[model samples]
Target: EPEVTQTPSHQVTQMGQEVILRCVPISNHLYFYWYRQILGQKVEFLVSFYNNEISEKSEIFDDQFSVERPDGSNFTLKIRSTKLEDSAMYFCASSVGRSSYEQYFGPGTRLTVT
Candidate 1:
């Protein structure tokens, strides 16, 4: 079975540094999304991409953040400048394109900014 995978399960960075958290989403899926959870808050959707274009994005996806499909199997999120508030667990999810289908989540990448 194929699944999403994220790198550097944990990362420590100074506020102001750039961080590129990587994810390889399952192939044969048409939708990809990025979400984040601040230690205790609800998971917030950042953006959704499909067919090589952004399908939707939330306010949290500000100018400092961007995503790309670098190759056939890799999806990446880049934070231009990290802030203390940026500390959170970033999750990459994929679905079979249905409200009833469960979106599979990666273990997650925990980013910490000081």
Candidate 2:
């Protein structure tokens, strides 16, 4: 089975800097999502996208955060300005449908802000 893949397994950046986390989900999946897990905290949803537009977004996804399907296969999360609180393991997930059971997650990109 095909799986989601992420680049730069770990990333370190200065506070207030911009960061773009990339992922390539299973080719056939239609829905994509961005989630983050803070140290010792449960996973939290950031946003969900479908048909090249945002379907839903959490309060945590503020003006600073944006999601885009830049091309046919790439989905990306851009943090316009990072903060210490943004440091977490960011996961990219996709599903054939909107059901939770169909979702598949990537290894994750660990973002550490200084």
C-alpha RMSD by candidate, in order: 1.1, 0.8
Please give, for residues 1-114, the per-residue lDDT of candidate 1 as tens digits.
888899979999999999999988888777888999999999999998888878999999999999999898888889999999999999998876846777889989999999
Which candidate leads in lDDT? 2
Q: Write the per-residue lDDT of candidate 2 for residues 1-114, one digit (tens) a residue.
A: 799999879999999999999999999999999999999999999999999999999999999999999999999999999999999999999999985557899999999999
Clashes (candidate 1): 0
Per TM-score, the best of the predicted structures is 2
Clashing pairs in 2: none
Clashes of each: 0, 0
Work out candidate 1's RMSD over C-alphas. 1.1
